[model samples]
Target: MIVASVPRTWFEEAVVVFFDVVRGTRAEAGQVLLPDGRALPGVRLVEGEHLAPGAVYEAEDEDGRRQDPERLRIVERRAGSDPAVRLEHVLGDEGTVTVVEGALQGIERPVAAQLRGSVRGLGRWGSLRRVHGEARVGLRAWWEAAAGRHVSGTPFEARLEHRLAEATVWAVPRPHGAGRWKVRLELSLRGRSFLRPVAAVALLLFRNRLREAFTDRVDRLAQVWNEIVLDTVSQDKSRLRERILDAAASPPEEPLL
Candidate 1:
């Protein structure tokens, strides 16, 4: 409900056309020609329309910019009123970040999402490799936007189901005024039985500072997301698919504008 003028119809329309946009990511006929006519290699849909569960894509890291390439599989896809997709960062036999899960749900529009993921081997320190306390968290995040005089928002309870040194996160946009909104991010920490004391101590020492840093980061990300939305909307509506495919095929940090 971020966009003030968007009603349930717009939300439905978005949902209907969303897959078309997603399918644009597929390297049609095994190649993606950039808008400037540069051919992007090493990326293609191996199965399905690249949206079906189990569809595979062989692509280079960073869309061929990185020398190392990886095969990504569409591990899961849910289609309907509440839809979501999950991709595996395939690394040989085991999926390092395999247990990750998230969903977008709302009666009319997307209002909240949740994730229970791991970060145990993220640091890759050999000594600390055995310290495997996975991070399982659920977060509800929100997005806000302004279209006219009022800012639109979604309400979420901010409940976090957590079992780690940290908690799950969620967001609900609370409107402040036109083109402005306030996002309140709440984090709770409840460690496993063995690490409760350490978790408590860490929270006591760094909670406030972490919150400030996270809030600043979220604000910056919100700006980037909104900019992309505005930029996408400002273009010719018929070129939506081209724009999406172009953007996806391009290397990171390069904007179509």
Candidate 2:
């Protein structure tokens, strides 16, 4: 089973704003937050690609050549201003599209785990179930912390309110085995307009030091959350892992059958 989630139109627009800001940063340095609530060195928005707010990518094939069809288009703007960074992406099906705005792309980990964990839990009943359950709950809590609550006051303060996102779960089912699954997770943002507050906060708190500080903040957030995910998967049952390998070795039959 594959469990996927994405935002609507405004979400896409918000993403555009984010990229625009990042581009701005390229032209000049700006303020950004650190995990310790202190400001870090500033930086210029350098580069970006098909990764926008509310989007994820996976190496579908062995060589990792195949990518998700819903490729995210990226752009950067507003690097010199206080909230001097913006990033954007276009999401959803061809016609009915939506925009998501946030500092940058960050929400693939948990999505992968959720997809795999759900399938694994169905086949076996033990630690995997617990791990997935804890992850699911944690994701919700993180969402509330970053996305659900609105940080009011100044525009910068408001945007800063929801810069980070909860973890997402991902899963890849073995085409050949019902009981086999591969699970992975990462922290990701859900809210569409969260970038506004994040940019706002950077301007207020970091002032002109937003560039390097923002990059540092994003890096630290990923490192900490990645550690959490790695620790959780440490105790993964060998049997389940074996099952996943077996399924991978023997893929599903062709549709012609």
Candidate 3:
């Protein structure tokens, strides 16, 4: 079983919201209503619902692979002033595990103290996370600086490195007193570019507005690229087939009046 806890603060809420947006669980039109009445852009939200205990919830992405919701847990409601919610999960006999930790240790340091400020922002909980050599995984995340900055498409050059300091996983045998096998997992990501001055000005002028715009821009940009490439390829393929057919056809040797 795996168990953990996280603060029930705005920052944590932001992370959850971001994931939902990326996963298409929440949409501006159907579910994810902004404080204002305007509709947000990017990916469209299709369906979402929480699972009850003993109930099975399954889903599939574009790849058509079935997903298990029991793998992840969200502590929606809390009882006390602990400020943090605990998370627990069980790894079945034939299950894949991918855990994320070390958000509190400020990411990682590359060369000098230049990376300190952003690292300090994630909070000093830990510095690493990992899993055994049992699965093929991919990590996708969009993070802004604590100073309120845009990390892409702008000219600013400031960088923040999110790295894992250490990671380890252990497996237990059937016998209660049996020994365990363990291995270390290494994960690292650093050097995120940001638009410092422009970001600052935008943040000063419009608080969370900058982050919201950034998210929308990223999503739309991806969608546009996908459409453009698919259209271009389709046109090129049609032209190629037409040319081939014309060349393969035989023409009359004599001209008809």
User: Largest TM-score belongs to which candidate?
Assistant: 1
- Predicted candidate 2 versus true structure: per-residue lDDT over 1-257, tens digit per residue: 21112222323343344334333331212222232233223211223322232222222333323333323323333222222222232222332122232222222222111111111222233333222112212333233323334323211111111123223333222122232222222222232245556645655776546456545665675566556444433433434333333333342342100
Q: For residues 1-257, could you state the per-residue lDDT of candidate 1 as single tens digits? A: 23222233444445445555553343456454444445555555656654688777665444434333345667888876666666665443332333345566643555545443433333344223322222211112233322222333333433333344435454444565654455555555567667898877877898889778876777787777677656655566666556656655556553111
| RMSD in Å for model 3 | 25.4
Q: Candidates 1 and 3: which is better by lDDT?
A: 1
Q: What is the TM-score of each candidate against the true structure?
A: 0.59, 0.19, 0.19
Give the per-residue lDDT of model 3 (tens digit) for 1-257: 11111112323433333333323322333323332322222112233443212222222333334434323333232222222222323233233333321112111211111111211211243232222222111111111211133333221123223342222222111111212111112222222235445544654777566457655764575466556434433344325333333322323232100
- lDDT of model 2 at residue 157? 13
Off by over 4 Å in 3: 1-59, 63-65, 68-70, 75-83, 89-93, 96-257
Residue 248 in model 3: shift from native, Å?
50
User: What number of backbone clashes does candidate 2 have, counting pairs of residues 3 or more apart or in separate chains?
Assistant: 72
lDDT of 1 at 209: 93
Off by over 4 Å in 1: 1-14, 23-42, 46-50, 61-69, 78-84, 91-95, 99-164, 233-239, 252-257
Model 3: pairs clashing at backbone N, Cα or C within 3 Å: 104-123, 104-124, 104-125, 105-125, 106-119, 161-190
Give the range of the ten consecutive residues with the poorest summed lDDT in model 2.
111-120
Cα-based lDDT for every prediction: 0.50, 0.30, 0.29
Better of 1 and 2 by lDDT: 1
* Rank list by lDDT: 1, 2, 3
Worst 10 residues of 3 by lDDT: 107-116
Highest-scoring model, lDDT: 1
